[model samples]
Target: MVSIKKGSLYIVATPIGHLQDLSPRAQSILREVDFIAAEDTRHSRHLLNHFGITTPLQSLHEHNERFKSPVLLQRLHDGESMALISDAGTPLISDPGGFLIQAAHAMQLNIIAIPGPSALISALSVAGFSADRFVFEGFLPAKSGARQQRLKKLLEESRTLVFYEAPHRIFDCLNDLVQIFGEKREAVLVKELTKVFETVYRDTLSGLFDWLNARAERQKGEFVIVVQGAQFDNKAIDPKTERIFWLLRQELSLKKAAKLASEITGVSKNTLYQFALDSKNV
Candidate 1:
């Protein structure tokens, strides 16, 4: 009795934690789809079973996405409705299924988006950071050096920064953040969002490190780290200096931008650096 359109591929968003977060529409489409393509058949099986959905499941993870797309597309061409679901959260946001979606477009097939829960958006909603303009740099590198190098690029980012970190490397990642972003940088760590042990811990980078180190239990869940962006002030300053500094910042890091702007404008380096941390830069 489900009204799912034949031959449409539904990019369904599953619940990140609480099972009830799944939309009624998502459940209906999933229940009636010809077959569901899932990131993990085993994990998606539990969710489907809970809702009493007996739809068949096919595995479509990062490893076999390329090879699997053609087969899935053929099913679509045969007028079969297909629903794609991840183990959790929306499919293709730091998860797989992007390739299949892309291939569907190339075939001129109807692709539907079924909105649902997302850990990234959920974390941002409660993190108390400015969400107007922020970046979602999914997960940092597992290795310390590569991760630190990656963090270095965002040192001057004026917009709020968000990242996902595994519990195993959370400590090392926080240590690198303290080392590069400075111990005093303001940040929030959200763990086990929307679940039983959901906790939101906001503190200076150094404080977070100590708190996590203090208790082994603190570092036991999935995490979303939201760091306050570079601060800026809305004070009157030389227009020429602002122009130069703003232009330089577009091409370089905060340190290099302030340094070069100071040189060009004959303004003190410290003064320009101060500009880098106010309402304007933020």
Candidate 2:
């Protein structure tokens, strides 16, 4: 029996996919709270009913969060405990609840966390990239131009990058990524995590793009993309390798040229790729 804290605003994390992934503490918190602020009441009602919890639910999504924050805060001030939950996974992670959480902070109420499943953390765990430092860019812009521009700015970032993507735009997103990030850049696509049809694919940008377009079924699921950040080694490249890079660039894209040149010279592709860019500017 978990003790429900009075006047506390619990930020509970629910299951991302698997029902059993919801922690016992999270279930207890939801059931014990005076009410739950859900991203979607209809969707959340089903989840609560599944767990045999009949906690009252009120809608609190991006559209109405700002307006409803004050009302919910007042309830908390009245010594009523509340739990904030998203449609799935952790609250405020590419989801709503920021306004309510912020209002609670202003009132100096208890803000508790009941952590559980998270798609971002789950994807990183199996991405095989350097997870020590990472950046989570929840969802890319819907437009092609904006998405490309956003990716371009992060081209030089040395930490792993994570993104959540919609199923319908997954292919288009990959196309833009390949264009800006280079086909030789390594990336991982995690789909339907914790679900029965879950898949984790690791490949170069081009390879993953090809594989995704090769089959229509692969494109139908929630996606989390983990991309390796720019990497460069300190070993100075000899003139021969530099010459090889130029030779390849004559017929290949900068990234492709760097990949081939590095293969021949045993130099770092990112280092050679950066050199290609610098040389092009000069």
Candidate 3:
């Protein structure tokens, strides 16, 4: 029982990479709508030109969404049906459209979704990770310290974790993942999905880091990182003891690794540092 009305707000998902992925319903809605509020007018124009859709487009991106959304909402109030589209993929998904959608919802405007392609979903579909329960972390913080803090918290996450990273930062992001999730953590890096030269590389965090490092120039385009959930090691490797063991194993003679691991795992660096000393002596 779908009731689509005039003067509505249609949240349409555009193709993430390939234009053919745009659904027929999405195309119809975009063509039939009075105007389209797009994250990028120029990019939307390309899609519109491809489909021969000449609907008017207005910019409603991060730079001006708060100011522009009210105007779009007013147009909706004035009996103009508007469709919201991102540069690619779903709107309000790590994109600028949440505020506009919120205002529309608050005003009780008729809103409909013309679903199509989502980079996150597409990546997850091919990630070979648990899709049953996962969290879309959008994009990681650009700052290393903040990113590491967040990753530290997520290290204990029981559900699959998904994150988007840019080309230039993908390698650093993978390196940070190795540091926080440990070298042996399994992960999938999906790049250029649905486009020419699409790649899905899966391996341990350390191996992935090494692979990416070897091909530093190949780290380009949007990246989706799918990390497997934490597993319960029932072998009685308590968090504290595990931290000590990993530190002792990796550091060998260097006391810094043990001290850092203890600080990160909150297992008392002094104690672990002492253990490192004892193990070295043995």
Using TM-score as the yardstick, the better of models 1 and 3 is: 1
Q: Return whichever of 2 and 3 wins on lDDT.
A: 2
Q: Give the per-residue lDDT digits (tens) of candidate 3, residues 1-282.
A: 243478899999999889899888888888888899988899899999999999998988899999888888998999989899999998888999888888898999988888889999999999898898898899999988999999997876667999999987888888899989999999998988899978999999998888888876668788899999876433333666765656466646445765566666666544554454445642
Give per-candidate clash totals: 6, 0, 0
lDDT of 2 by residue, 1-282 (tens): 689888889999998889999898899999889999999999988889999999999999999998999999998898999999999999999998877887788899999999999999999999999898899999999999999999998887667999999999999999999999899999999999999999999999999999999999999999999999887653477878877888888889887887888788888777886666545641
lDDT of 1 by residue, 183-245 (tens): 999999999988999999999989999999999999999899999986645353588788888
- Total clashing pairs in model 2: 0
Give all candidates' CA lDDT scores: 0.89, 0.90, 0.83
Model 3's alpha-carbon lDDT is 0.83
In candidate 2, position 156 carries an lDDT of 70
User: Stretches of candidate 3 above 4 Å error?
Assistant: 1-4, 234-282
Ranked candidates, highest TM-score first: 1, 2, 3
Clashing pairs in 2: none
Model 1: per-residue Cα lDDT at residue 281: 58
